[model samples]
Target: MAVSQHASVRKTVKEDLGAIVEMIQELADFEGMSDGPKLTIQDLLRDGGFDDGVLSNSVPLFHSFVLELTEQIRTGNKGKITSCSSNDEPLTRTTIIGYAICFYSYSTWQGKSFFLEDIYIKPNYRKRGYGELLFKTVAQHALENGCKRLDFHVLAWNPAKYFYNRMGAENLTESEQWEFTVCQGKKWMHLPKTIPSGSKPLKS
Candidate 1:
């Protein structure tokens, strides 16, 4: 599907916070995300909308429309955005259809740069050109930033892999070169100490 182009993509501000949060919940329900409600409206407002907060780190200023799906259109109801922003920009609604979120990262193996994240469209709003718009928006941003690649992982169950492949994304049969490691809380205390690094076992 060729991406349908859009004329403007602007930054969102504090005023748009309510709508953003609504969308977050909508995405949680759509994705069947178990921890959706775990994130409350106050969490978003305090961490993101306020100065020096979680929103500042996790979401971009005005372009954090990460989840895609225009459920409101198909359901004949209004959708929401479940986050906050620095600017109160008007939420541009165009049968939102879907959303995509991406950020910059370096590929130590390839010695280049790329994007890693998800693009989700509401189940009911699929194939309405909203997905295309989101993809195009991200792709253009990737190119503009001089990134050599734009990539994402799609689950086998999604069946969107076919569409991604058709859009020129290469699939690997054996991705043995890549390995993931994350440390949090107790796990973070187990590793060797180097420059403020340590992983210690928890006390009973």
Candidate 2:
């Protein structure tokens, strides 16, 4: 599956936010973690730090890249893929099949690094090299920005482990003594105060 011939990757625009949010929900559903997505369009816009055309770390928490089909791919009764007219403008009516969201961080020991927070492709569109293309796109940005490493997490049960390993990703658990940990689950929604101070959790 030659990825170049299928889809084009680009930075998402304001108009693409709704569809991107939908894809995020689809990913969550596939993982069987939750039903709807925890993030919202407004939240994305706020934390994404889209200021006067620059991604200032002080404002936005993450950056994203969207993969859109070049040809029309039916998503719903009315959803269809469209093209960007001027190359710089966002495509209208285009079906976004996948996306890669990342956030930059300092690794202390390794210097600069970027975490691939979320990468997902519509199930129907998987196995066509789209996933690899998305991964490479994010990696390209990481390198261009002087990042020493790119990190992300995958469920131990996920078959995608084979793909990651094939691409030279290391398994810290087996290769070293580092551990991966996260804070969520039972105590998440029941928190006494908002985690980000003024932000609201996604609607249940």
Best by lDDT: 2
lDDT comparing candidate 1 with the true structure = 0.54
The RMSD of every model to the true structure, in order and in angstroms, is 10.3, 9.4
Model 2, 26: alpha-carbon shift in Å? 1.2
Q: After superposition, how far is residue 43 of candidate 1 from its true place, in Å?
A: 6.4
Query: What is candidate 2's lDDT per residue for 120-185, written digit by digit as tens?
Result: 889888998988988888999999999999988888888888878877899887778677875788
Please give the distance, in angstroms, between residue 119's alpha carbon in candidate 2 and its true position after superposition: 0.6
CA lDDT, every prediction?
0.54, 0.78
Q: Name the regions of candidate 1 deviating beyond 4 angstroms.
A: 1-14, 25-32, 36-63, 66-97, 109-112, 173-181, 189-204
Q: What's the lDDT for residue 185 in model 1?
A: 62
Query: Model 1, range 104-192, lDDT digits (tens) per residue?
Result: 67776654455646566656756766666667777777787777788676655667777787677777644544444458766578544
Local error of candidate 2 at 11, Å?
1.1
